[model samples]
Target chain A: MKISEKLARETLLEMQRRMLRIRLFDERASKMVKRGYIPGTVHTSIGQEAQVVGACMALKSGDHMTGNHRSHGHPIGMGSPLGPLMAELVGKATGVCKGKGGSLHLADYAVGSLGESGITGSSIPIAVGAGLSAQVLGEDRVALTFFGDGTANQGVLYESMNLASAYKLPVIFLCENNFYALSTPSHTVTGGRIVDRAAGFGMPGVRVDDGQDVMAVYDAVAEAVDRARRGEGPSLVEVMTYRFREHSEGLRINVDYRNSEEKQFWTARDPIVLFREALIAAGIATAAEMDAIEAEIAQEVEDCASFALESPDPEPSVAFEHLFTDAYDLEDVL
Target chain B: MSVMTYIGAIGAAQQEAMSADPRVIIIGEDVEANVYGTTGGGKQRAEQGDFVQQFGKNRIRNTPISEEAIVGTAIGAAMTGLRPIVDLSYSSFLYMAMDQFVNQAAKNRYMFGGQSSIPVVFRSAMFYGLNTGAHHSDRPYPMFMNVPGLKIMAPASAYDAKGLLRSAIDSDDPVLTFEAVPLWGAKEEVPDEEYRIPFGVARTRREGCDVTVVGVSGSLPLALQAAEDMAARGVSCEVIDPRTLVPLDTGTIVRSVLKTGRLVIAEPAHRTCGAAAEIAAVVADKAQHALVAPIKRVCALNMQVPFSPALEAQIYPTRERIVAAIEAVCADQLNAENRRVG
Candidate 1:
């Protein structure tokens, strides 16, 4: 696959911009949490930016995606506005879910980011349904669902995989193996190799070892998405990534979950640093241009924080609103 | 009007909904084989005539023994654009898919700020008259009613079974339709023409001025029979059937209680925290001024449904129990009146 100079440059810059935005957004969100601007904890996607950007970049705008709890980067990768995402984190009325769903339940349907679930691996079945809908309605759209290696143990994930295979629904199951299911090692909790389980469902399974390399992640996800859209059913792609921070925002720093040497190894392979080096080596962009892009993303993330801070808290009287779609009078039940 | 069995009415409702809308699909265990007979089992029941041949194997899918996947898939499909009708076979099996049913499907609309609506109908056969024992026979509508976003319907008659199901399938919210397994063979006049019974509306089966008796699902017929028996003894009894439990028609029940000045709630579920308790509370809160006697509840004993036929019969509400409750309320009223006159 020969990539045109212009297309490759644009793709590389866009991926870098998305990774920068996620990194900066999480940095700002962590500060906001400390200052009490954000109400609940956020599961930041600090080190797994390339996985989110690569898989989401390969998808078209009309294609669907279901994200996990540690999914602050997904909406950005899917082209959702940063203001609404930030406002939602602060529990403001201007938030995407009107302050109802916090960081974990972020959703932006405009960019085909269907929704993210607080439940682990729950979105897999939902993505299958979306894929099934496309097949039933005779649309050419595909659905991509992102979950952690911890979700590999969820029974519903296997059920969704079997159903997707049986019905030949257009779906890509991307497992972001971050090696931890909240302080527990994935290998200790998971029975076998996560990618090998896809073979049991009779679907093609691939593993991208260098998740920091955006091109590798993109190439693997692009192939899987293509196979799905071509009516070849579902495929599983396991992106071996790592998270730089704690599982949640307010967790103790020295939780003895992973050793200091292991953290140092992943920190050295930072996705943004590696991608920045790749782009400069390939003459896609100069070091000065990359620095300028980072500065611009930092300002954009600051603007999102300001917008969220200025947004008002939701009125308490309307707490019971949006419980149902129909005109159900609460007075009747009372 | 066409005479149809309760099971046949359910099949007719699904077939009619499927024929009318292309998006409506049925996913269940052994739907193609019709093994459980709820989807007009075994093909001899005229309601499910040529379903597999007409709709093909794609729409009428047979799932593996995965209840969680069955409901989760339907919720997903419904969240997208497909209107799915998922059959969980037995109401007791709902325990298996509690996470999907209670957490995911019921809370998705509210938790997502109403951005998503699950137009899925979880159909399950309920009740224990057939001696299916404890595991197969529990009526779990009260458990579902505890959830906010779920609409629960337990149709008592063939006509209501067909009509309410059409409405449930057409509804944009998640609906759990509990078809009484004992009433599957019960025959009644169901309209051949397409019709829908809206939720939260109570049907006044028999009008009377002396006392009010409320029935739900399988208990409606028992209440009506007890009403007939009470009428022979000159105690006129009004019977009300709340078709949908979540969107309960408290107005109808309250008004009937105000008119009759006596209330007796009859249900097959256990006595504690059951549908009867909810109705009794509504009447006590809203129409307590008109009460001539204490509200009586003719409900099943607070014990597990026994496997033995005789024990199950003793445990559940009977026409005799309903009659006895009505007589007690009437007698209590008479004693109060006598005390006031003295």
Candidate 2:
């Protein structure tokens, strides 16, 4: 069903908060990296706010999802506490993964957020396996996974999809096709539309209008999530979004990735603006109220950064610890 | 009462483990009535229970032929509180899942800074014999033993195999148990009960005076054979089988080397960076003063193992090489002692 009247207000409220959190976190992380506060760079999920919020909103308690490098938006969308996400980026003990897993590996399975892997398309197989586990455990949980448009071309993705479909696993393959895979565009790199590729795997496929509104993305995911819980196997959903920011903070500027005009063109139709307008049109929120929400989230993220900065670094031995239940002679092995 | 082969001991141990603990689940290719599974076996053996029926399939999960995915999921499950016995039917297939093994399971506990434990056990068979060729045959104990987070156990005899396999299963950390194929057909009487041999302890199968011989995997038998022929030749050698390589029971080996003053390491695999090198290095490092002469290693030539019987015989380490290597070490010891006396 399209956004039910009851869910419309709640969905709009969720849309505004999540979009703001993701965009704010990404912008702050970008600035932190630039200011040398966060050591490593991040593949900020800046402009692609709807994919994370929409897909996660569609999931239930048992449903889980895995993310990719551009995962800041992903965890934010999964209701991850912004404090831990910021702490992890800043390499503090207070981080979600205790600072071990930087931006790429943030995970809290409790929130149905499994993890985001460093290797592209690696999480697809894990999602498949976790979906398989959910099926075996009789949890009726769907594992929703997001890989870039380029990841659709990887052999492992195809393999994972085939295996999931073969087992009729409760998995949702969410292809966030932001046009380019690093420097390569969808036209040059991918063979065809990711939907067609999903068709080849014998799974129901959809190409959602990622840019027009968040509800469209949410509706497509709701259908897929429903089908997954009913044990109808997996579905491939290619959300046509755009990457608003550069790949990572360390990247000075994308040299040949996309034209400046194209980047400018997509930034105008930002999901945050569309979501705010939707809320305003529905009389659920005012422009002033939206600004206050933005301010509130901004303050929360700012405190998260300060908390990350104030936290102590893990002891040196902490680095070498956990290799084994029993202590290992690392010096001996070396 | 019944004589059992190494393979039988393993099967019995699995049946016993599954029967004893509901948590003990098995996952692998062909584990459920497949070609290599228990489907083709004897009538008296009672048809093997598929993982689905035995462990409820929920625990005894199967997956596609992706070793990476198999191992990755197993590691994930183990971390999330499940004791999984993942089977990499062939030891060589381990190459495909090395990241999950070496990187994830091996490093997860440490990466999370000891926040979690992976109580998963990986079982695979290794041996150069059986004409499986190079691809199917490899003794990866040396490669895995060096991994810090993992406990690598490769048993040479039937008793050690059963006991060590049991212990590896119970370990809180991830453990690797490599069953030697050549020893699979070798039969012996194992106690019809439960037992476990702790890792790092060495078992001395034989005792002598002139030289100390350390062997692992299928090479132990060849060492015992050489000891017999050498005993007749007046070169009495002590054979020490360090049952578990990583947690090496160097105490027994060092004590033997202290008495004999000469040492020789024999293995059925390549010499460079093999288990042989690790043992020799350990001896030279810890038992330096005890060694009368530099340690000598007798191992497979650094070359491809061929299918032809003659070439295969020449390619792998044999009793002749062990005997020769022991003799050379003894001769060198005698020469050094003589020089000192003079």
Candidate 3:
């Protein structure tokens, strides 16, 4: 049975909503950091939200996902509480990682948002292992890894791709090629097209127009996910996107390398606008309904921000806790 | 009782653990059949009905030439409830997978606020004598010893190798199981029944009222060999092996030093920030009042280990060097030193 057009459109719109939530949360928090509201560098996925959401929708409820440092969308897309995610950005106690891990270090284990790694491509092997776990555990679950163009160059990425392919592991390595990797362009760092390298590992790979349409990314993800379920192998999908903001809260992205007009081009192809336009065209959701959805999300973010602020800071004694498993006999340490 | 070389002892332990526990899995480059380049050919020697023979392709996996993924997968699998004894063809290759070892495996459980247990054993052949060159021969013990959550085990003889490997296999935390190149060929008689050499236990090889000698990993045998030579001159020496590094057996070594008053630290790695320096500091900190003389440390120079046999032999901390250091510390004195137990 084919997926209904209305369902696809709604999914696409939901994807846009998750993406926008991450963008605005990071955008506001980044301003806060500059104004002495927060302390710490922020790696925001401002321009690449659509791919994360589109790919996340391709996964089932129990399916797993891993992310790179620039992953605030992983938990939200995987069905985590948006308030905690936003609160985490605001450095509140109610944050997803309890404010311990900021933008770069978010994890929602309940939703199987496995983790995000600060180290480039480190999560590839972990995601492969998670996929292997799903297979071994007979869960028929899939694991998705969202890394940047820079992480694609890492040896672990190739290793992960090869191993996942060899065992036919239910793993998908999605490379969000948003041009510059922390000021270094993808072309300058990677030897060739990111997916071209993935091909060397015998896995099917493709270059998708990430900013063109959410439907484009969703279609690619669905096929790749079906292939994984069929026990075929892994796929490296290089989604070409852009970073509208700086690499972190402090650094500037639109500079000598990329034209400012490129930002305007991506914004014009904005995923929310694309999905909203598609929904309107399909007569699935009206303009007023979409406005209501946006208001609901905004209100949700606001409530969560307040809840996070009210939660007490983790006590200092909590630091000594969780050093080891309960099996650790530290009666002597005291 | 089966007689095997030190390297063979580790192989037997791996084989036994795999046979007893179906959950135990092996994944590394060329681990399936004819696992070439181990001190001995483990793949060729695998017995019938063994893990490699019985489980065949699915359970016992041989991966592509990727250490980072091999370790990372093992760590992941281990966390998800599987005992994975992953291999890094050589210790030098460990540098390629530092993130998995140090960041993921070492700190994962603690960083997760103790919500998980990383029960993985990372087995790698370490040290150099076959002239495999600098990249292959260099001993980076400092890297492993400094990692907070890692338990490092370097077995010297076949007896310790079998016992320590068994202990490491059963351990809940991650263990860095390293076998030195020189001791891989050293054979000994090991008991057939299962036995365990607990972590943080220091075993004495020789006892004396003269000087306390401490060596770790494969360096213990070298210290014992030097002690044997010192026995010729009627200079009694105490030799101790602190089996595990992270949860160091400071009690045993401290008592020995207090009894002997003089201490000698012999380590295969360089002199800088080594097991020797850590041990010396512990002795000075804990038993400084008992010291009759300053501690003497015998180790390789600060330079990298070269490939050439001559240069390699010159750079390594040798039994002769230990003897020379012992001579300097003893300084022709029947003199006041303590008697420690073997």
Candidate 4:
């Protein structure tokens, strides 16, 4: 069945709600990073909220997903609560990963967000593994991983694609191509087209050009996820999106790599605003309903940030914890 | 009792692990064809059936020459549910997937605050003495030993190969087995019954009193030969084989050093930051007052392994080198000032 045929009004509104959650959460995270609350650096999916929510909301809660460094919006899109994620960014004991992974390596397995990697293409194959697990265990679950246009150049992506295809594993390789990779234009480094490379691996490839349309991305990914659950093998979905903020927050590279015209073009196509307009026009939600959703998410982000700030820091003994499954005492080993 | 070669024993252990647990699977380059001969291709092939014939294609899988995906797939499968044994044909090729092996597999459990344990086995062989050139002839276990989230096993004999491989497969965390190509054909009597050698426990190959000789992985035979030669003369030597490097059995070595009052560490890897260097540091730190003479190390010369047979021979630590290091450390009158005066 087509996603549009069975798409409920509640589901459409939920999609926009998730997009709003990502928007306000990432915006709050940006302010907190500038205020020296979040340590190191944070890569936000601020402008790419539609690309994150559309693909994430297409799957069931039990289906697995992995992401790259720009992964704050992924778990929120998958319906994870904001408190643990915000606490993770603040390196508190209440964090999803207990203050060990920080922003770059957040993993909330409770929601089947396997983990996220700081490496560009490292987590792609891990999603393939999850797909392999689903196939081996005879489960109807599928696994999806989100990477970037820059990570598309990584050799591991092709390796993982080929492995998933050859084994007919239920996996989806989602490339969130936001045009730039840390100030370097992706086209400068990338070859012909990422979606076209799927032909070499004998898998179906779909290019979602208007990734700003939440329904468009959701339709494409839902089809692939359906095919994967049917044991029809993997597919590649490259969503054309753009980042509104810099590649990472709080770090100054001081390069005018992105021209003002192109910046204005993508910024004008804000995914949240576009989705909000689409929902209201289609009569799925009212202007007042969208406003209430936005207000609710804004309040949610504030409460999550406050909870993160008030959460206690992990004890020093935690440094030696979680290194192994069995007993390991640093004092005895030393 | 059954006599088996080192490679055969490793295959046997994997076969047993696969039969015992349905979750265990093998995936790598040409694994279905048994290209490297470490995973499977044994007499049991006809008896219990081969990998593909027994468990079918899903359990025993073959992949393209993609080391990164091979390891990453193993990590992912291990994290979710299955126990995957990934064979990256050679230790040198492991460098191609170090990001997955080190960054993903080794750091996954720790970085995720122990949310999941990665029960994956990564098998790679060091084909040094076979003259596979610089790219293929790498003893890279020392490099992985430095990584904290991994369990490393370097088995020197057929018995050890079978037992350690079993233990590695049973381990919850990610484990790496670095097999030596030269020892693949070495045949020895292995127990037909199941057995497992615990990690962090040293095996005494030879016992003596004058000097303690620590052999690592592929250097065990050389240490044994050197100890025999030393015994022919008047020097008594004790040889300790540290089966696992990460959880190194420092207590055994420190006790041996305290008794013998002299130490010598031999390893096939490079001298700098090698397993021998770590073992030497442990002994020096633990039994400093018990030492009658300074510790000496017999290690490969710090350089890229050359292709030429003669040059490669000169770089590796030989039996003669081990004997010489033992003799120097166990000298009758070992005072540095007295030796300089003489």
Candidate 5:
């Protein structure tokens, strides 16, 4: 089923809006990281916008999600404001997590994002846990976790799938197979199709071959999310997508891993541009309205960057804070 | 008061906590079957039968031998709601889930800037003296003590087992309870009324004037026996057990050392950077001027725990070694006094 048939025109436009938010925000973040605004490195969801926004938009606001190192997009897709996320990337006091998590770890509990992890395949089971909580508490909320194809081969994924299926948990194991894990091509390391592994665990596995199509990715994830909310079980949705930029901004991996032709092919199918054109072609939005959305997001991205840069650094005392619920001095405890 | 084994007290605590809060649930390998003798093999389980039958399948959930998922799921659940008691069975197998345990459970609250508290309990038994072999036999509490966000509990008696377990369940932060395998069968008097032992409080087992000896986890018995032996040998030795390692009661140990003027730390874990080392360091830092003699430590040798019982026994600290260390520390003060007189 097409999302356009069921979803409101505004919601469809919002999907494009969020996708654009991810694109422009990440694009701005990329430039900022290179310019020494963001500390460490930032993994931007530049090319894989549709896969991120589509899966995230499928769930209700109360539904939970966990992400990997490519962190900022999941929360943005879940409708988190751009300011705190950008502020967090800059290590500011007003940042989400109060600058403790930084860029690699971003958690906005206000929007039900449990948190993202730097370690691949680590946060996968955490989403399963959110599903477990919902079931035990008799809540209708479902949980979805995002991981890369590189993390697909991790044993924890199989362990998590087996547990979720055994308990009939309300969870969606969304594999963002962006074709590579850093410089290593996933095909070189991954033996079988990632979606096929779901069959072994007695769950339906759906692969969205055209992950660049936001609606296609949405239809698959929305169905999975529906099944999860109805208490059927967990489902594995592998979205075949690509990363337009390098693995991480400011990372100098000298290896010429991705060829120019392959890069151009993915660059042409940019999820944001594709969704914008689709919206205009369907008469859901006029070119001027689409232009206004892009302009609005561009302004939002600028405001976020300015807010992050102008924000104050966290107090030095915050380093010892939040270590435990009780504010015992670290010196005394040690 | 009633007589109960250490492991039995743990079971009582679990049943009590579950009864008190519906949010409390159990998840791990063989928790329903009570294979490791943690959940069932006691007076409580004998009366209640299978936990699955008592709490139903939803509350008493079992999982495949997936330690990583088991730990990670508990962290996620804890963050949202529901206090999970994850039975990892053996402390040695904790390595399989270290990423979730150390990276997620321990750091989640702090990493997220106090946005959420991970109120999960990871229960694992130390199997060092059970001849479980090198792979299984390990007192890994010292390693977890080094981690910041985690609260570590080592209950030496049936009373403490019940009380501390209750505290761990009630705590908002993530706590790891390391149950000593050797102490599981040992019986002690536990109060009939419910009680909770606060973390960072050191329990003074015996009072003395000559030296302060700190015993960690399973090694508490050795220190107590050594203290008794020292009493017979005309040496007064005070023994302290820091129940929770992370929120260590440095105040108690420092005060004890100030009164005694000497300190000796004993632990079942390896000698280097073991619990003993941390306790000794705390005493040295806090009460260095009061110390009349150097602090000595009695710990297992830094090596892979051998499969042979005899070889393993040789590596771990013994009552005799504890006594010897006390004697040497006491005599060292005398030598210092004699040298000053000359």
Candidate 6:
């Protein structure tokens, strides 16, 4: 189904807004890491913004999501506030996890971005659990989890799929096949097609070739989300995308794992530029409106960085706090 | 008070918890059929008794033989809202889901700045008395004790089993309860009324002054027997059981050591870096001045649990080993006093 048939012009523009926001936010985050403004390395989703934005756009506010290490774009796309998210990246007290969970562990439960996992294929079962929670509680909220091509080989992912299928859970397993699991080419490592593996587990698996097109990702994920919400069980949507930057910040720049030709091909299909052109070509938005959106997003990203910088560092004494719930009553037990 | 076996207490705990809180659910391999009989062994076991018929398959769910997925699902479900009580048939299979139990379930709360709580119970039957070979016979609670943000409970008696399981279900953090396979059929007087044994509280099974004996999990019964035998021989051994290992009752143990002036730790796990080692370190670090003799640890040898019943019996801590350790500690104290007087 075409996205234009279901969504209005404003919704299409908003999708572009989220994509641009992720792009600019990632760019600034990369610069901050380079300048030593951010303490730890940040995994920027620069080239893969459309997949995150598109998938998040298809879900309701109460729908749950779990992300991986390279997932700053996910919570941002799920409508998390820029200030706290940025604050968390900079280890500020005002951050979403109070600065305890920096870049890799960012979580905003209010927006149903359950949390991001540092372990590959770890969040898949977590997403299944969220789906189970919705099912057991008699809610229509579906759960979505984003993993990488590298995580396809993880045994736990298969186990999660089997459980989700057996229980008919409302979950969307979105695999972002960026051709590499870190430096290892996915083809050399992964045995069979990931989509086919989903079919083995009794779920529909679809491959979306246009990772650069936001509407394509939105439509594919929207279908999966609808099936899950309808209690039709889980579906796997593989969005083929690429990472323009190194695997992470501070990696060897001259690595030859990915050839120049491959890099150039994906670079030419930058999701933001492609989606912007699609919007203009479809006569849904003017060039001036596109320019205005970019300017607003740039300002929004700048404000996020400023707020993150101005936020206070967590108190040194509070480091031991939150290890367990206050109701634990360790003192009384002793 | 109602009489219940160790396994019966476990089933009662599951039934009461699920009845009291609808959010509590069970997921594991063979939970529907009770193949391993972990819920209870026999015709009227908990899994056999109308749980699937009443709670439906959604709540009392069964899964494929995937340890990682079972634990991962429980962790995820716990984080969202449900209190999942997942079983991993035997303690040896826990190695398959170490990443989920250690890295994910244990560290999620601390890593996420306490924004999420993994209120999941990973229940496993532990020990080596069944001659199930090395793979099936394991008491690996010490490995979990090293992980922060995880509460480890090893209940020895039927009464403590029910009470502690209930407490674990009510706890907001992730808890791993290791039930001794040998103690499953051991019966005791458990009250019908609801009760919960708080974590980190050491229970004094017997009081004495000559030597302090501390046992963990299945080793507690051996220590109690040794204490009785030593009492008949006029040794006056004091027995203490530190129910939960993470928030260990160091104060209670240290006080016991100060009063007795000697300590002996009995455990079923490997001697090196086992629960006994941790308890020994705590007593040595805190109550060293009060100790008149060197601390003794009666634990299994640092090797795999053998399949042969004789070999397994030789390896694990026994009542004779506990008695010998107590006698040696008492003898050393006397020698030290005599040497100082001379």
State each model's CA lDDT, in order: 0.87, 0.77, 0.76, 0.88, 0.89, 0.88
Candidate 5 stretches greater than 4 Å from native: A1-3, B41-47, B332-342
Write down the TM-score of every candidate: 0.95, 0.90, 0.90, 0.96, 0.97, 0.96
Please give the RMSD to the true structure for each candidate, in Å.
2.7, 3.5, 3.9, 2.8, 2.4, 2.8
Q: Per-residue alpha-carbon lDDT of model 4 for B33-110, expressed as tens digits? A: 777885454886767666788788888888888888988988998989999998887889899888998889888888
Per-residue lDDT for B42-114 in model 1, tens only?
A: 2454654666767877778888777887888788788888999998888898988888887678877766666
For model 5, residues B191-235, the per-residue Cα lDDT tens digits are 898899998898999999899999987789889999998776667
**Ranking according to lDDT, highest score first:** 5, 4, 6, 1, 2, 3
lDDT of 3 by residue, B112-229 (tens): 4454577788888875777888888867767798886788887778898889988887888898877787887888999989888887778888888789999877778889999999
True-vs-predicted CA distance for residue A222, candidate 1, Å: 1.3
Structural RMSD, model 1: 2.7
DockQ of each: 0.67, 0.37, 0.43, 0.80, 0.84, 0.77
Write candidate 2's Cα lDDT for B1-342 as tens digits: 467777766766666676677666676776765344422232234564444555565555556687876776666556544567887878888888776677666775655445557788888887577776778777767788767788888888777887887888788898888788878888887887788888888989899998998888888999999899877766778999988877777678878988988888888767889888877777788788877777988887888767765567776777888888877877855466668768
* CAPRI quality of model 3: acceptable
Task: Report clash pairs, candidate 4.
Answer: none
DockQ value of candidate 1: 0.67
What is the CAPRI rating of model 6's predicted complex? Answer: medium
* Candidate 3, superposed: residue stretches over 4 Å from native: A1-17, A86-95, A135-139, A188-192, A210-212, A252-256, A317-334, B36-50, B231-235, B308-311, B335-342
Q: Tell me chain A's TM-score in each of the predictions.
A: 0.96, 0.94, 0.92, 0.97, 0.98, 0.96
Q: Best candidate per DockQ, number? A: 5
Best by TM-score: 5
lDDT, residue B304, model 3 = 76
Question: Which candidate do you rate higher for DockQ, 2 or 5?
Answer: 5
- Report i-RMS for every model: 1.3, 3.0, 2.2, 0.7, 0.7, 1.1
In order, the TM-score of chain B in each prediction is 0.94, 0.91, 0.93, 0.95, 0.95, 0.94
